[model samples]
Target: MANLCVAGGTGQVGRDVVRLALDAGHTVSVLSRHAPQAGSEKHHDGATYFAGDVTTGAGLEAAVAGADVVIDCLEGQFGKARKRFADGGVRLLEAADRAGVRKAVVLSIINCDRSTAAYYASKSAKERVYQESPLETVAVRATQFHSLPVAVFQAGAGVGLIPVFKGARFQPISPLDAAAAVLEAALEPGSSEDHRIRTVGGPEVLGMREMAVMWKSVTGARGRVVELPLPGAMGRYLRAGLNLAPGHAWGRETFVSWLEKRRETL
Candidate 1:
């Protein structure tokens, strides 16, 4: 276990990464706008909190100083959120570069084909920070987190909201799986030297609507599942081929299991 700096460590995925690292007896420092809430910090045995803004250089250098690795699990902002996220990512990467940190892990998305959506464009750019850097790095692209589907889009006419294009498919994995993958990548540390690896979705191919139904059934939520329209040709292409990996996907979580686990929290 190495000393680690986790950016966006308060997020769903980031929090898990911190937990896994600490469970393994690794020391952790989390970068957030403010220190993570006391409850979150107290759970990790070897945790330190760093208050810094990734969007700017403020306090960033100090936060990452002497850390073994830096993991970025940031979600871009809402209005042109991608640009803001991309810029902030660059700042963090530059700081990492200047500080001479050897390894970094950045979480990217699966449907990040820029032509397909504006969000993808930003995601693609933020990913560049790892691929282009001279530092040894790991870039893991994952499909949407399994349990967060409700937050992705809303279903107006139904209990479950299934956003679809020309039959888009997804292999949503759990936040825990994604977090574990990122940690593994950091330890082994992939580089552009190796083929870019995408930690895509899992064993089954399910439409967004099907996912909604599964979640509803597991949670016994009253939500009705509805299929919504896709916006354009780009959305159609993405819907048709975006989130799936042909085979050999390293996914370890399924929607059903993800829901069952969430039951405890609910």
Candidate 2:
């Protein structure tokens, strides 16, 4: 079994990666700001937790020591996003290279380079860091998560109406599905030396308006979806379907299916 270290393993998608990696029988280590105690979530799953912060390079070398593969699921937003996502990645790669780690993997947003949004631009920078780093690495780009649109709609609920972008296209995959894709990238033979970008997305491409309606139906949200044509460079990019990966829709989870599954769990 390989020694796999997950940076930011305590996050929503990162947790899923750690779980799946553990299930695959790899010696899993979680690098987070706070190492969980014996009974905590990170420790309970048979993963060794290491305290580390990639942004400032604190404790990273120790966490990355002897790692065969390091999967980065770090996230951030706005101006800070570039630092946390891109700069942090550089720091992590430096540590991984010094520790003699063989392979590295980083997760990024699909078509982030084509978008003008601050967050997407930051993600694009992060992808570039992996591309330029000498450490064997792959940048896997995934479409938006299922929870993203739901959060947008929920946030838009005001005066019994949900306002959403009229033509925004999204191929929202489940977070777990994205995590599985990342694991596949990590385990692929000789994939570490391949620096090409790999894209993965959901089974279906749905508009923002349609996703908003589904969110209302699933959560029984008391609001009607109001489609508004977003006018901006960012909106133009989204409305053009740049976010949808038509050639790489490898995920099986649909928006409605994911919602139904969650409903059963509740």
Best model per lDDT: 2
CA deviation > 4 Å runs, candidate 2? 38-43, 79-81, 191-194, 264-266
Residue-level error in angstroms, candidate 2, position 186: 0.3
Q: How far off is residue 179 in model 1, in Å? A: 0.5
Candidate 2 displacement at residue 180 in angstroms: 0.3
Q: Could you give candidate 2's per-residue lDDT for residues 24-139 as a string of tens digits?
A: 88988889988877776656468888898887899998888889999999888756556567889889999999999988999898888988887888889988888898877888
TM-score for model 1?
Answer: 0.86
- The residue pairs found clashing in candidate 2 are none
Clash pairs of candidate 1? 77-81, 159-223, 159-224, 160-224, 160-225, 168-239
